[model samples]
Target: MLVLILGGITFSHAQTKSDSLAIRQAALDYIESQHQPDSAQMARCLHPRLVKRTFWKYPRQQREYLRESHADEMVLLAASYNIKGDKFPPNPRKEVILLDVSSNTASVKLYADEWIDYMHLVKLNNEWKIVNVLWQFKDANRHQ
Candidate 1:
């Protein structure tokens, strides 16, 4: 019985690690699909009910504003570059950090060249999808 319990614990740990890796991959796919203008991959990584919000700073006016975007809009934006035949830089500076994970829910932070995004994800039907995002531009003068 003791051996069986130990085996179960080990299996549980392995499952958690596997889930974490899948979550990370989902987050990476979200970012890469957008950067690459790959609509299919973007759709795969994003939930149908995704809501993305961004805080924009108007330095000239010394004010900030909130902007909201839905999943459809995001997919359209991701594909916009493709429509225009625009090319992105070969190597863009980006980072994805897994913040937390609990069962079917997770949070991740993505640092891109111009902005930082906090993404909320959920495991749906055995697939991880980004459900929400809160982002802001990287301000050099801002204090941490």
Candidate 2:
């Protein structure tokens, strides 16, 4: 009985570690895809209905507004945003922090070159997909 219990605990611990790795990978994929300007890679980690939101104020506008970007737009951005390779500083930052993970759901905080994104991911069909992201400019004054 003791051996069986230990084996079960070991299996559970390994499964949790596996989930953590996958969650972290999904977050990395989301950021690196854009850094690499690979639309296909960006598309892979995003759910079809992914919704990315931000709070922003246009120069000509008076009040801050809620801005949203869908998966299609994100994919297009990944394709063109960094094509010139000058969009970001040399040796840009790309950090992924796995905030939490529970069975089929996970949350991540991604620190990218120009912004920070809080992402929510879900496991579907045995794969992790980013479903939502709330982001803001790293330097509040910088808007791209």
Candidate 3:
């Protein structure tokens, strides 16, 4: 009985760790797709109903502003921008930290080259997909 209980606990812990890794990978894919402009990979990371909100200060503006974007727009912009020229750094500073995961829902923080994104994800159809993102520029002076 002791051995059986110990084995069950270990299996449960392993499953949780696996889920955490998967959630982290999803967040990484989302950031990488934008940096490299891979539309297919971006689509794989995001859900169709994704809602991304960005907060930034405009040039010479005192107050910050908010902008919203959908998954389709993100993919379209990734394909349109920086395709011909090399805009991103050779080794951009990217980081993904898993904040929390509960059953089918998870949250992660991604520090991309220029901004920090707090992402919300959901497990759907046996896959993890980013559903929402709240982002801001790393430097308060820089604006989009």
lDDT of each: 0.79, 0.86, 0.82
Ranking by lDDT: 2, 3, 1
Best by lDDT: 2
Candidate 2: tens digits of C-alpha lDDT, residues 25-105:
888888877777999999889999999998877777656788899999999998998898878787878889888777788
**Per-residue alpha-carbon lDDT of candidate 3 for residues 21-82, written as tens digits (9 for 90 to 100):** 88888888787776777888888889999999987666666677888999999888777566
Candidate 3 lDDT for residue 96? 89
* Span of ten consecutive residues with least summed lDDT in model 3: 7-16
Query: Which tens-of-lDDT digit does each residue in 15-66 have in candidate 1?
Result: 3888888888877777777677878877888999999987666778877777
Best by TM-score: 2
| Model 3 regions lying over 4 Å from their true place | 1-15, 57-63
TM-score of every prediction relative to native: 0.76, 0.84, 0.80
Which pairs clash inside model 1?
Answer: none
